[model samples]
Target: MNKLIEREKITFHKVKPDPSSLEFGKYFTDYMFVMDYEEGMGWYHPRIAPYAPLTLDPSASVFHYGQAVFEGLKAYRTEDGRVLLFRPDQNIKRLNRSCERMSMPPLDEVLVLEALTQLVELEKDWVPKEKGTSLYIRPFVIATEPSLGVKASKSYTFMIVLSPVGSYYGDDQLKPVRIYVEDEYVRAVNGGVGNAKTSGNYAASLQAQRKANDLGYDQVLWLDAIEKKYVEEVGSMNIFFVINGEAVTPALSGSILSGITRASAIELIRSWGIPVREERISIDEIYTASARGELTEVFGTGTAAVVTPVGELNIHGKTVIVGDGQIGGISKKLYESITDIQLGKVKGPVNWTVEV
Candidate 1:
């Protein structure tokens, strides 16, 4: 443990449930975990208390500077009635990486794990029983020092909140979504905080997503900021394509978040006897492959939706349908395997799931 938590701070709130109309991230659990840090004084007084509003001064650095980072992961209830977290260590490591980029202090990984485990234990009933539903755990850090200077804040707060989220899509799995390739607006850039899970990265993408939706597209597929031809990612998920019997994705390239699900999928593909490559993939290559009938599938991978297939991609006034306008062979198998492992139907590599 980082430091023993103050048991007195623990509190719970009871509420009625409405299953008919559950929206993602709308409701939260009764209790949350919090820890504070100051300039010379180190982190102190870890507490698990009732979820409530945070009061910050009008001139807080975060208000003006936007120094905030967050991570999202899920805890599932196995068929045998046990709670488990999938690859939690990876999330903490990613959190530390984001902290470094945002100039926020990093907590001990062991401490974070312990704190999160305790939080889940306190709110075990909140973990949904439905197969496709689970407790969405969000751990975030924000600068809290009261100053208007354009610099990192000296004081900070780390908190964890839980949300019971169902499938991001409705009743049936989503139809293959149409994505718009935007060359006018960019999401991230090289030598920037693109690789970090910072709030600004997502806030920057919202406007483009709104524009795409207005244009009858499901989401925006952002391109490289410099050349605007290299494919980066789709919405918040990592993008993948199957071409010429191979699975290909754009390399990390210092400008994209390396998703945990993305890394897992690549390893799973390798085990399935498919070659996976991470290299620069230009939009021209995608168009060329589709035109030559070599493009088989396209999909996006993330924790929220797990895996979603993309049927149509619109690039610069040209619309291309992938593989007869339906999900491809590899896409179906990958989805089944990954979902099976998450729900405990199939065995996976060691350390993939941690018992709750």
Candidate 2:
């Protein structure tokens, strides 16, 4: 059966006219893409219309059971006035990974790509061309079935929304920031849904992050669930460390998110002859490297921030500092190359940029 779509024009909240003044995820674009799914009928009701409120029953399964998944990406405008999407296929694949863990139906890749492309085109005016700014795209799925049962819902809703966002880190280049070690809580456990981009994973990390922030740290560095010693991630981003002139990061232990930006950085850096290794890294190793003056750099990668430098790491009542509290040589190069590809300053891998 064909999907049914109905369009509606709604009023948008007026804001400051300039995109440069906009904060991250504050101002939204004018339109959105929505669709609904049912058990027997499958997904239908695709629509591209004005952004508005979604009416849901108080007992909706998503409200109670927390069966929700989301993906974060961006639509960037290049120097030549052409809008493009950076690695959207990776986002679609990751979204499906989240759906499987959350017990939601897997979305069709082609359909999703089309929906996103059309939505980006609809909001092309919202894509900021200010070098570090772009239109942030959020695609999410929720269990909308009005039942309190603990099982997966028979009905769901999928939506894509856009927000014109500015630079995430700040105006200046990324400075090595501080992070607090989390010993009391674990972000993910073995054989759990930690690798999935689900809401619960993020929700579990909030308290630890709050404590880190209170300690004047920029983020929380999570550890393994059992030992609480193996360095896992830095909140929403994947982590990397430099030791002995080689780039190393924790292996995917099924408890850490495989960020798209993380993969891109690995590829870009390795192409430049940097030795990038994925292995299990422990807190002891990080501190020891810093103590020996062998730790070259530490950074986190994600969609929002792109790449962030970690200058000081606080763990188990000890403070470890890396390289004069400044961005390392490799970190700077990776940031520049990735931004160049994203902003269309340099040539990219084949089909890396999807023109809208």
Candidate 3:
């Protein structure tokens, strides 16, 4: 669409690794898409070049001020030899929203989508056909202007790279995980960049995540910055609860990432004639519900894991087992349903999958 992304000749190619042995985000494809933005020249010079390292100035704004944003989505190779992308348009739209929030130049959604499709098509051979493997696409923008001032940079670099990844879970089995309820550290505030997929928000989460890991937990469950009582999100996914037969998740209170998978899960569950509500759910309420044996299940949703069952939640020093400390029926159903749609095994909602 944008002048047919210029491709550099590939002199050599990397050998494909064993899909079962693949680790998440460890192996990259042969090519990548890149574009640049200037203060007055706008975004230009879109190209598809050989995957290589980037050279940036020492004082680049991104390194100094951390004005960067990124998005993640996967490309799947179906059994029929078709390449499918799940809701790529939504991912591109969210990328632009993150750009706007970080004071970076907004990309043309149509152009971005076209570039992504082209890149994935060029690297179609790298898309794993294994049962739990897919191509992980990372599209990001970084402020490139070499300056130290605490302000937005005048230039930026937008790029997309693809990695063939195995299943996000370490084990082949989809086992439930233990989560540490984080009250001492805050991931974001009402006026912060929590809603945006920026680097700082994640960097700020490392301390709590490390503490959780030290305490033998798989992930940290964050709470609201203001009240420090309401549940926000898990380490990298949106948290959900099935209390008294109703699906519940924290409302988007300007401090929570509006996850696409979270929204899709809600829609799919509601389509089954079940009730799903987006509202404030405090930690105390969850504990109380578990105490009363009313909390049936707890799960998390994200592009990485798709659906992760929360077997145990450690609030402060008290731990509560959820649904026999095993993967709930709802969690397994949602995981299978979403994976089915992604792999083209079953038809999903209209326009949910875009063929590459």
Encode model 3's per-residue lDDT on 1-356: one tens digit a residue: 55757878689999998998998899999999999999999998889999999999999999999999999999999999999999999999999999999999999899899999999999999999988889999999999999898999999999999999988996744799999999899999998899999999999999999999999999999999988999999999999999999999999999999999998999999988879999999999999999999999999999998999999999878999999999988889999999999999999999999999
- Which candidate do you rate higher for TM-score, 2 or 3? 3
Candidate 2's C-alpha runs over 4 A off are 1-17
Encode model 1's per-residue lDDT on 101-184: one tens digit a residue.
Answer: 889988889888998988898788888777578889999999999988888899999999998888777565545888999999
| Rank by lDDT (best first) | 3, 2, 1
**Candidate structures ordered by TM-score, highest first:** 3, 1, 2
Alpha-carbon RMSD, candidate 3: 0.9
**lDDT value for model 1:** 0.88
Candidate topping lDDT: 3
Candidate 2 lDDT by residue in tens digits, 1-356: 12444566666644534876877787777889999999999998888878878999999999899999999999889999988899999999999989998899999888899889988987788888886888999999999999987899999999999998888876854967898989998899978989988888888888989989888998999999999889999987899999999999988989889989999988988899889999999999988888899998999999998899988989897988878888999988888888888887887898788889
Candidate number with greatest TM-score: 3
Clashing residue pairs found in predicted model 3: none
Error of 2 at 189 (Å): 0.6
| Model 2, global lDDT | 0.88
Model 1 TM: 0.96
lDDT of 3: 0.94
